[model samples]
Target chain A: MLSIQNLHVQVEEKEILKGINLEVKPGELHVIMGRNGTGKSTLANVLAGRDKYTVPQGNITFNNESLLDKTPEDRACSGLFLSFQYPVAIPGVNNMYFLKAAVNAIRKSRGQDEMDAIDFLAMVREKLKEVALDESFIHRPVNDGFSGGEKKRNEILQMITLEPQLSILDETDSGLDIDALKIVAQGVNDYRSPERSFILITHYQRILNYMQPDFVHVLMNGKLVKSGTMELANELEEKGYSWIEKELTAAD
Target chain B: MENEIIKKSIAEEYKYGFETKVAQDTFPPGLDEGVIRALSDIKGEPEWLLEWRLKAYHHWLNMKEPTWAKVHYPPIDYQSISYYSAPKKKTLNSLDEVDPEILDTYNKLGIPLDEQKMLAGVAVDAVFDSVSVATTFKDTLKKAGVIFCSFSEAVKDHPELVQKYLGSVVPYTDNFYATLNSAVFSDGSFVYIPKGVRCPMELSTYFRINAANTGQFERTLIVADEGSHVSYLEGCTAPMRDENQLHAAVVELVALGNAEIKYSTVQNWYPGDKEGKGGIYNFVTKRGACRGDKSKISWTQVETGSAITWKYPSCILQGNDSVGEFYSVALTNNFQQADTGTKMIHLGKNTKSTIISKGISAGKGQQTYRGEVKIMKSAENSRNFSQCDSILIGDECGAHTFPYIDVRNSTAQMEHEATTSNIGEDQLFYCNQRGISTEDAVSLIVNGFCKEVFKELPMEFAVEAQKLMEVSLEGAVG
Candidate 1:
């Protein structure tokens, strides 16, 4: 469903993502693990079409269509979703209203009838339960004054509601308590199907313990250095990315 | 379909341009004692009122046009404009008898004169050019012990009330525009809520500028008696013209002991095109006086259309424990310029005030927020809080803030906060990833910025104000 070939990216003339090559087929769960500043977040941002990351070379394709040329919104309508590392707090915009607008925009692009307010509310309420978010959160401003755990859960709630074809969860487990993490993982696990795919980007393997991945990739120095089964996550957790860095240095 | 499209295009081009072709009684273009006398005589004012007009006329001659505002335009040709113009031989007894051309102008402006289409139980006083064309629900208001009519009619019928509160808050020499408005003002709504009476419905006045080469100067005075409450709304629009028209208006409110008055304005004048050729220059002075113990006054406005707008609706808290508030959302697009905010003067013990202002500048427009908060020596333990935020759509436009705070009492607590920022690329990108368009994202962010102020409006008006913001910010993003 998603393919990247030698994705070279930069920010302010400094290379961030150096020749990243990855592919995720339908129903596959791929996890990318890296230390802080090892280009984990930069890769997610590039896939989501953030403007700050300059793509120097290479190409990305989604569903056999060129994804690099599409706008971020067009990418979203094409069934791509990015759970931000830090959710933005938009004061005065109700979370429900934002969700409705987003859903309608995607649905309209897909030639579906827009949902009415009542139906939209009903639909989001069921999704909120999956993430253990309270109904009161719907009426409040999006993420304004929200606690750290609440913000992460809210992101998962949106991911559930959007039901994207390729979902990229960037640090969704950070700042979440044990219960919140389980709920977030449950929301992600429930959405796992043969027709949908996900890319989990995180530093810790704690969340991987809840929902296992089909494949694990270690990113270091703007490049994916190794790939293996879920057991690689436990190996990296025991021996940190320093071992991976040494391996890359020696291989070079 | 062709006609509908043409009409829609016209509506979009000149949102407020509709003319009334009534035979108008206009004086020669000039400003002098003779013009004041002519206006006074035309209204058949009593002796004392005529004397008041003459006094104001002389006081206006010595005063200079105010230059402190951030608005700059060519000096008004006061000498080449008529001071009085009224529909000829029109003794308007009912809305049906109002001139068709005048009614059409109102219809085009989206103010239906037909009572059936208006908000249920609410009243409207429609003013075209320089006179009140029709005032609905007057009888019902009178039954509730409310005196709602034109200022000219009030001068003749309720002289004592008009004289007592006309310039009580904003005197003749208060400022340059007020002085001019006090001198040659034609007509405006006069509202008097009796003691302990809560007004049953919202009182609104719609002011339209129609005649060519004419300046609109109207004065509004609303007094809420002891323990009474009232909410007054003012709306203004003008036709599309290549020459900027001068509009100088004065509005004053008086709230006695335990009374409250809320004033709102939705100003949609003809904002000049991209090149800034012609539009209305709206210069207005609005103030409210909290005269007795525990009185309160608040001002809210949404300004979206104008070439140059210079107005500051203010409050004077002279009563112990009185409260004052000002919530504003000023938007400027396509060469529009607005310098607006408020003033709060605390004179009595333990008075309080709050101010929230939001300025949105897009499409080469310039917007500025200017305000003042002053606490006098008598105001012991007075408190104030102010927050001003500005959002710039494009790099070409400018956003500015000028705040003045003065506290004479040592016990006064005053706090002011302000922020100026452009829409960040990250915020846009975040929304874009949610499948929302860039334009919708801008609208959402701008709406969030002004939500603090927009929520203060009434429910219906809050929705209208949101749509107005979207329209004002159109074509602002690349």
Candidate 2:
């Protein structure tokens, strides 16, 4: 469903992602693990079409179409979703209202009939239960004064509602407690289907226990240094990233 | 050659020059006591009203235009423009008899003047140029001990009330524009809520400037007696014109002890074109006074129009424990300029006031926040809180803040906070990464910046203000 060939990205004139190549087929769960400032989030941002990052030397294709030329919203309409590390607080915009606008925007781009408020509300109610969020959350301003756990759960809620073909979860488990992590993982697990794919980016290996990944890629200093199966997550968790750093330095 | 320069300057006045073809009754351009007398005579006003206009005219002549505001403009040629112009229509005794052309004009301006449908619960006093065209829901309002009508009609029917409150809070010499408004001011709305009476519905007035070579001068007065409460709304829009038309209006509100008055203004006058051609010069003076203990007054405004807008709706807390508030969202795009804020004067014991201002400047527009908070010695234990935020969309635009805080009473507590920031590429990218467009992201961030003020508006108006923000910030994002 997604392919990145030699992706080299720069933000503010500083190269953040260098020579990244990855591929994910439908129904595949790929996990990217890295230390802080190792370009894990940068790859997610590039895939989501953030404008601040310049793809200096790379081509990204989603479902056989070049993704670099599309806007973020266009990418979303093409079924690409990003779960932000820190959700934005859009004050004065009701959560339900924003969700409706997002849904309508994407639906309009796809030439589908828009969902009315009543139907949209009914649709979101079922998704909210999957995330265990209260109905009152729909009436409040989006993420305004929301707790950290609530923000992460709200991100998952959006991922569920949009039902994107490819979902990128960037640091979704960073601030979550044990309960929140399980709930977030449950939300992600429920949406796993043969036609959909996910790229989970995280700093820890604990989230992999809840929703196992088909492939685990270790990123270091803007490049992927290692790729393996779910066992690689446990290996790294036991030995830590210093071993990876040593391996890279020795190879250099 | 000087005539060419003057004509160029005059053409530059109106930024929006979209005209609506309609016939109007306009007097020859000039201002004097004779002009004022002719205005009263044309309306068939009572002799007392004629005397009152003459008095105000004499006082206005002796007063000078104020220059204290942080605004600079060419000197107004008050004597060179007509002050009174009303569309030539049959004297309609009812809404059904109103002229279709005038009704079409209002419809074009988004004001459905139909009495039975569009304006069902809304009591509308439609002011076209210099005259009141129609007032709906008067009978309904009268049944609730509320009086809503045009200022001219108030002068005739409720002469005693008009005589008692006219110039009470904002006298003729209050300021430059107020002085000019006092002299040869055509017409506006006047509302009165009887003592202990709560108005049933919102009272609204739509003002439109339709005549060419004429400056619109309207005066609005709203008084809520003791234990009474009322919410009043005013909106203004002008047809596209090439010449910068002058709009100098004066609005005064009086709230007696235990009364509350909420005044809101949505000003969408014709802002000049992209290059800053002709537009409305909206210079207005609005003030409210809390005259009794425990009274309250609030002002909320959404200003998205005008080539140059200069206004500061203020409040004076005179009664013990009285409260005052001002919430505003001002946007200036293209070549538009706006210098607006509010003043709160605490004169009573335990008085309180709050001011929240949000300013958005896009393109080459200039937006400023000028406000003042004064706590007198008599205002023991008074409190004040002020928050001002400015967001700039482009590098060429400018945002300024000038806050004056005066606290004479050591026991009074006052806090002021201000922030100025541009829409950073990082924030935009962040929203974009979340699948929101750049325009929607800008609107979201701007709305967040104005959330502190938007929450102060009533429920329905809060929604309206958000939509207004979206409209004002159109095409502002890359």
Against the true structure, whose DockQ is highest?
A: 1
Model 2 alpha-carbon drift over 4 Å, by segment = A12-16, A136-140, A240-252, B1-18, B45-64, B90-92, B424-426, B448-463
The TM-score measured for candidate 1 stands at: 0.94
Top lDDT hit: 1
Candidate 2 global CA lDDT score = 0.86
Interface DockQ of each model: 0.47, 0.29
lDDT of candidate 1 over B114-213, digit per residue (tens)? 7878765667788777888888887789899998888888888899999888888888888888888888899999999999999998888999887877
What lDDT is reached at residue A251 by model 2?
Answer: 87
lDDT of 2 by residue, A123-235 (tens): 99999999998899989888889999999999999989988999999999998999999999999999999999999999899998899799999998898889999899999
DockQ measured for candidate 1: 0.47
True contacts kept of each: 0.75, 0.42
Candidate models: Cα lDDT each: 0.87, 0.86
